[model samples]
Target: MKRVAILGGGPAGAFAAEQLASAGWQAVLFDEKLAWEKPCGGGLTYKAYSHYPFLLENSTPKRFVTETVLAAPRAGAVSLQLDQPLLIYSRFDLNRLLLDRAERAGAQIEQARVLEITRQGSRWRVLTNHGSADADFCIVATGARNPLREVGTQLTACDTMSALGYYVPGEQSMIDIQFLPRLEGYIWIFPRCSHLSVGICGKGEPAGALRKRLEQYMTEREIPWKHGSFYSHLLPSLHTASWRRNRVTGEGWLAVGDAAGLVDPITGEGLYYAIRSADLAVRALLSEVTGLAEKMNLYQRLLRRDFAGDLEFGSRLARRVFHGRFLWASVPARMVQFTRSSPRFSAIMRDLFAGRQSYLDLRQRLLKNLNGSLYEMWMSLGFRRLVPRKAA
Candidate 1:
């Protein structure tokens, strides 16, 4: 039996272990904390659940949010009714669920921290604090803070975003997304089953600045964030050049999830990419490719064909979407306004929220519908002018 060592127990590692073990491969997964919370929204889009039905059919405690409110610096807010609701889960719960699935699939789950990984000819020797293990292959899924420097994406300071937030003891029916001025990222309030994950993520900005912005927003909205638990983490937001040279696989090893920097630069969405990359990695390893080099190439090709190319394009657009000026206003402000005034634009936004829209064709879609959107906005303004004013 071929032994596969997975150096993480997050969604990506756990999912890979499940697939490999089920295929009769001996899979061993190692993680210091098998299940833990993260400073993220932990929301899964329609594309995720549609691709993996088990995500939707599971008995896990989750929140299905169908409404989202988008706010910008001067655009106020616009309520959008989602055609496909977002499935929100606590990271700890989600990780536990994936880990449980791997265990049930015959994977050996070890609660240990990986100290180092050494290459021993065609095999790998994984050194953990608890013990040592040998494997025919290695899968790196230790997230953005991967301790194994020899494997995974080489992330520089510019290739990451600081994500920090509070798990507030509150509840709401809708998700709130607030776009700030001059920031490369946005703030989000995602309501889980029991609490709200109110967080801020920004690139090229200090964590202290991000936290202050989040606190001010919370204070203005009276969210009482001081009473909530604070958490912060790094999110991979690879630049265009970084994507071109991203090292996902080499020798007898492959990296998945954040370790591979398979994250959406614009939306800060990683869960879908994490799971999707793991699936592709396992498929490539189990393929009929005769050589290790061929298998690694296959994995790279699979990722590019699946979503890496799209994410790379998204990296180019991230700055424009956040900081660019549109129609004499900030891009985010214009987006909210367009969503309110134009039905065509609103539909596009809905598709984006559901993950049905791809960044590769976003410009074409917007350009194709720009005329209709403008006409709708003009007509909406004219209709409002025609309506009689309410009596004081």
Candidate 2:
């Protein structure tokens, strides 16, 4: 059987190992912490479950969230419906489930830290705290704050967001997102089965400011948070430019998930991209269209094809919205009002958050609906502008 070595057994590595193992290939997964309590909210979008049905097979601690409340700066909160519910889980539970699935699929689990990797003749020599192993292929699935060496050397640096949050014991249902004025990120509350994952996140902002804002938000919302542990972490913010400059594969090795700069720069969502990248990487290797080197090259092509368009659009949209730019007929405040007043507008947002719509499709739909909304307003009530157009 062809052997593969996977470093950092997070969702990316674990999912890839499961796939390879199911296909009768030898897969070895190494991770120091197989079940980790990742600090941020652990919520997967709709298309995630749609793509991988097996994610819901286990009775792990999780919750299905349907409603969401969005609060723009200096605006009233707008409650919207998630037609396709979002699923939230504790990272420890989620990672444990991923590890269990991988092991059950015949992949060997190594609970050791990877120290270094060297390229030998037609093979990779991976050094671990326990020992070393040689494999035909290697995958680096280590996340944003990993200590692994330059496994994917060609990979460049991207902006990493400082994420700080708390898991408070509470009974809440709706997911809340509050946009900070002029900040490139937002604060959120993702409700789990028993507790709420609450936090603030931003790109290109002060760490102290993020905490101060989080505390202010908790106080204004009257959220008593003396119950759960507070934690802080880093999240990768790779949007269009970063995507264009980075390559996930080289020679006999490939990078997946955060290591590959696959996370959404805007939403800070990487679950879908992580699993998707690993799946495509395995397919590219298994194809062996030419040789291992050529197959790996194909992996890069596949990632670009699958990820580029949406990422570019997301990056542009984030700049416009978060930086307070106007979108033809709307700024952030006007856009929130549009969502509050128009069911059609709300549906588009629902799809965007639920991962059901691509950025390209969302842009097209919003533009088309803008004209219709204008016409509707003119015919009914002499054209009231929900979103005011800024003077150029």
Candidate 3:
């Protein structure tokens, strides 16, 4: 049997191992820290659960949130009732769940840090701290902070964003998204099973500045983040140009998840992409193409045909969505107001939150509904103006 060396036992690596092993391939996964917590909100959208029902059917501890509050400067706040609830899981729990599934599928799991990966003719030689392993192929699922420089997407300062936050001790039913005045990112408060993941992520900003902004927001809202555990990490938010040249696959190996920079630039969503990319990679490797170079090319084509193109478009729109002005207000502010006053726009926002909406067609949808949305907003304002005032 052909052996495959899978690096990084996160969602992508674990899922790939599970699929490959189930298909009768010899799969071995390596990771020093197999399961751990991350700073970002670990929420899976409807698109994820619908594609992979096991994610929701599992016995892992998770939270289902059906409500979200979106707030923006000068636009106040608007409450959105999600038609499809979000599945929130602690990163550690989620990682453990995937790893368990992989192990049960006959994958050999190793708890050792990968020191280096060298190509040996047509095979691979993986050197770990504990020992070395030889495999016919390699799968790089290492995250954004990948230590192996020879593999995965080469990320520059502009291709990443700083994500930092605290796991606050609290409980809530709804999710909170706060958009700042001039920042290229936003703040999120996602309610997990036991605690809240309150964090901020921004591009072209230092982690220290993002942390200060998050702390200020927490203080203003009386969230008591001082007593919470702090965490920070980098998220892949590749530029449009970077996507065209993204290094996903090469000879005898392929990269998956954050290592390949398969993340939603606008929303910072990676779980779905990670799982989806892993599935695609396995499919490509298992295809009857026979040629190694052909399999690598097939994987690239599958990714672009599936979701990479959409994410590339999103990267182009990220700046405008966060900082662009619309009708004398910021784009985020207008988005909040539109969602509050227009049912048409609210439906769009709901779909976007559920991951059912694609960025490639967002502009078309917005332009098509602009006139009707504006009329609805005007009518809402008129009705509010006609309401009787209380005693002043």
Summarize candidate 3's per-residue lDDT along 14-67 as a digit string, tens digits: 999999999999999999999888556999999999999999998999999999
**Per-model RMSD to reference:** 1.0, 4.4, 1.1
Query: Which of 1 and 2 is the better model by TM-score?
Result: 1
Range of the 10 consecutive residues with the lowest summed lDDT in candidate 1: 33-42
lDDT of each: 0.95, 0.81, 0.95
Candidate 2, residues 1-392, lDDT tens digits: the string is: 27999998989999999989988899999998788987768989888888997776568989988999998865578898888889998999988998899999999999999998888988889899999998988888987775765665243344577889888878788999888887888999988877888998888887788988988888787776667688997787765666666756776789988888777778889888889989998898788497777887788888878875577667777777777655443266666776776767777888888887787787778788988765553543433355556879
- Whole-model alpha-carbon lDDT for candidate 2: 0.81
Error of 2 at 173 (Å): 1.0
Q: What digit string (tens of lDDT, one per residue) describes model 1 on residues 274-337?
A: 9999999999999998998999999999999999999999999999999999889999999999
Clashing pairs in 1: none
TM-score of each: 0.99, 0.92, 0.99
Candidate 3: list runs displaced more than 4 Å.
388-392
